[model samples]
Target: MMMVQPKLTVVGAGPGDPDLITLKAINVLKEADVVLYDALVNSELLRYVNPNAEQIFVGKRRGCYRYQQEQINELIVERGYSKGHVVRLKGGDPFIFGRGAEEMEYATAKGMDVAVVPGISSSLAVPAYQNIPLTKRGSSESFWVITGTTKQHKLSEDIRLAAKSNATVVILMGMGKLSQIVELFQKEEKNELPVAIIQNGTTKKEKIGIGTVDTIENIVEEQQLSNPAIIILGEVVNHRNEILQVQRNINSKLTKSA
Candidate 1:
C-alpha cells in the first residue's frame, strides 16, 4: 500500500450558507481523506470533497450528541494516521467559538501536522444579511460578540454589562436564554431597544424575529425560533428596517412618476 503522511486540517465551513465558505476551504476539502463535520455545518459543502473521501458526522446539537469532545479528539488522531488527511470541518470561524485551538494542540501533541482555514463567522454575516450594521458611526460606535452560555452551561454574566452599554451586542447559542437576556436589558431601561433574532441565518431556512427588548421574547415564541440562531441588540437592529423603509420610499416615488 502507498504511504501518505499523517496530517490534520481544521477548516471553517462558514455560517449556514454553503456559498459563504472561503475558496481555500474548498481546496482543502478536495484533498481530504476523511471529513469530520459538525451539526451547524451545512452538508451541501461536502460535495467539494474528494469522491472517495470518508465522511463522518461528529455533530452535537442541543440535546443530541454524536460523539463527546474527548472522543472527537481521539478520532482526529486515529483517522489522521490511518487515512492520511483528516479534515475537521466546523461551522463559522473555527477559532471563534469552535475550539479549533484545542483540537490543533491535541492533534499536534499526538504528532499530526496541522493547518487552519478561517470561515466567515455567523455573528457578523447573519446580521449583515438582514442589513443590520454592528457599528454605525454615531449610532453604534462599537460591538460585542459574546457567547450565550459559559463553559459551565450557564447564562454569561457579561450580558449584564453589555446590556448597560451603547455598543451593539451579538449573542450566539442564546435562544434558550431569550427571556433572561431581555430582562437584563429591560432592567437597564432599554425596554424599547431594537432586537432581532435570526435562525438558520444566511440559508434558505432562515427565520427572523424583529422587535425590542420588551417584545422580542414573545416574538420568538410566536415565531417558534430556536438555537443555531444569532441574537442582535442595539440601535443597529433598527437599521435593518430603516434600510427597508428607504427602498420602499424609492420604489413608491418611481411608481408615482411612471
Candidate 2:
C-alpha cells in the first residue's frame, strides 16, 4: 500500500491578467493533482497545469456561486487525500477579501499541509495601471483599501471614515453602492473630491469614468459600469492626467526636433 501525503496550496492568480501569475505559482500549478480556481482567475494560466491534473471551477461571482465556501473546503480535503496535492487558485491576493485565510485554516485544521503564494492585489494594481497613484509623496501619503459590501451585503462602515480622511481610498466590489458612497462623501462635504471608477481594469476590456464626487454618479450611469470594478477617490486621481500631459509635452519636443 502507498502512503498518501496530502497537501493544499492556495495560490493567487493576480488581477485578471494571465501574464501576472508568479513563476512560483505556475510551478505549483504544474505539480497540482487537483486545482480549484476562481472566476477572476485568467483561464489561460490553466495551461500550465499538467495535462492529467483535475481542474475544477469553484469560482463565486455576483449572483452565481458554482460552489459555496463550505463545499469548497470539503472538496479540498477530499481531493487532497485522493489526489495528493490540491491547489486552490484565486484571483488577486487571496488575503485581500478573497477568504483565502479561511480556506487555509480549514485545510490546516483538517490535518493537511498548507502553503500560500501571494499575488498582486487588484486594489493596488488596477489604479496604478491607469496612472492613478494610490499614494503620492504629498497629495496622498497613505491609502486605504475597503470592501464595497460587508458580510450582510451592506456598504462597509469603513467607507464613511475613509471618505473623511485625506488618504486615497480604493473601494472593491462597490459599484452597486455608488449612491450610498456619494451620500457618505457628500456628508463629509467632499462633494468636489476627485473620483475614478474603473471596470475590468488592467485588461483589454477595461473602461474608466473620471469625475468629482458631485458628478461621479452620473458618469457611472453614462459609462454603464458594474461589478468587478473598483472606485478610487482622492486628489491623487489628477496625477494620471498630469503624467499624460508630461508625456505629451515630451512627445511634442521630440516631434519638433525630428
lDDT of 2 by residue, 202-242 (tens): 88889999999999999989989887899999999999999
**RMSD to the hidden true structure, all candidates:** 1.1, 1.2
Q: State each model's CA lDDT, in order.
A: 0.93, 0.93
lDDT of 1 by residue, 102-186 (tens): 9999999999999999999999999999999999987899999999999998999999999989999999989888888988998
How well does candidate 2 score on lDDT at residue 246? 100
Worst lDDT 10-window in candidate 1 = 60-69
lDDT of 2: 0.93
After superposition of all CA atoms, the RMSD between model 1 and the true structure is: 1.1
